[model samples]
Target: MMASALLAGSALALSACVASLAVGAAGMAARGVAGTPTNNEQAHPAAATDCSTRASHYGKVSIIDVEQRSPSKIVVWGTADDGKQRRSFECSYGTKITGFKLRPIASPR
Candidate 1:
């Protein structure tokens, strides 16, 4: 019957979706097991898409762009809280290459 056919079709579609999700999850797990950064930190070392990361590090700075120029160096450019136009940062990923927090800098330039 048409109703039975429709039910079978729906079941097939659902199975496909579930299988796709499982594959995606497996791929992600493989990447993690292979020692890849899940947070996209490997690519964008100093990138901050929102204010929280900026605020946590530099306090109320509006982060616009972040680029990793070198393995140890990153440049963060954005408008500051006091409305400074060219406020920026050049930071190190820390002693062990763990970029958890921005270290103290003597100057911005």
Candidate 2:
């Protein structure tokens, strides 16, 4: 009898879990159907925090171009400096950035 009761309790718990998963999937689909940014109340870009901020003095950044080299790789080209001088920098993002390619410039753009 105890074994039967345990089995019943296990079945009930599993059912609850399945129901919760279905609800979660439905909510996600509804968000897609609504065609909204989903975070309209938020005042920042979702990936703003993901961007690297290690440039010198946090100088102005202008994205010259962005290219997706692969499914998980992106190449970013731009220039940054602390007003003393300007430099062109290219940053590659994949599993990790194993390189730093920077070239000095005579002026800011």
Candidate 3:
């Protein structure tokens, strides 16, 4: 019980941190301080890139593992449509993503 709680808390913290980092990086770019591409720009390329173009597009995630708020949701992190790093989760039945295999992002072939 305690272990599950800890795991859930850790997951939540990590998710929040990832979100904050992405947002912060975007904010910095918008200011043109570093002349770096903003998150929106990064997201655009990610969207264009096909998931199959990269072998590491899919990964395993524990179905029974996740933060309390999204305990039943399975999270997967990888490149998105814009070719930028992104994370998404789906319900267990939406796909076998939380178990046997994870599906890849579809591309406009």
For model 2 the TM-score comes to 0.44
Q: Write the per-residue lDDT of candidate 2 for residues 89-108, one digit (tens) a residue.
A: 77665544534467788652
Model 3 lDDT per residue over 1-109, tens place: 9999999999999999999999999997877875643223223223223222332344322232222224233332333233542333332211223222334555446
- Model 1: colliding residue pairs: none
Best by lDDT: 2
Provide the overall lDDT of each model, using Cα atoms, as 2-decimal numbers: 0.53, 0.60, 0.41
Residue 19 displacement in candidate 1 (angstroms): 1.4
When summed lDDT is taken over every stretch of 10 residues in candidate 1, the lowest stretch is 91-100
TM per prediction? 0.34, 0.44, 0.29
Winning candidate number (TM-score) = 2
lDDT of 1 by residue, 5-97 (tens): 999999999999999999999999997888732333464543444323544444556555666655544445554343333234433332222
Q: Which ten residues in a row have the lowest lDDT in candidate 2?
A: 40-49
Model 1 residue 29 lDDT score: 95
Better of 1 and 3 by lDDT: 1
Runs in model 2 lying further than 4 Å from the true structure: 1-52, 56-58
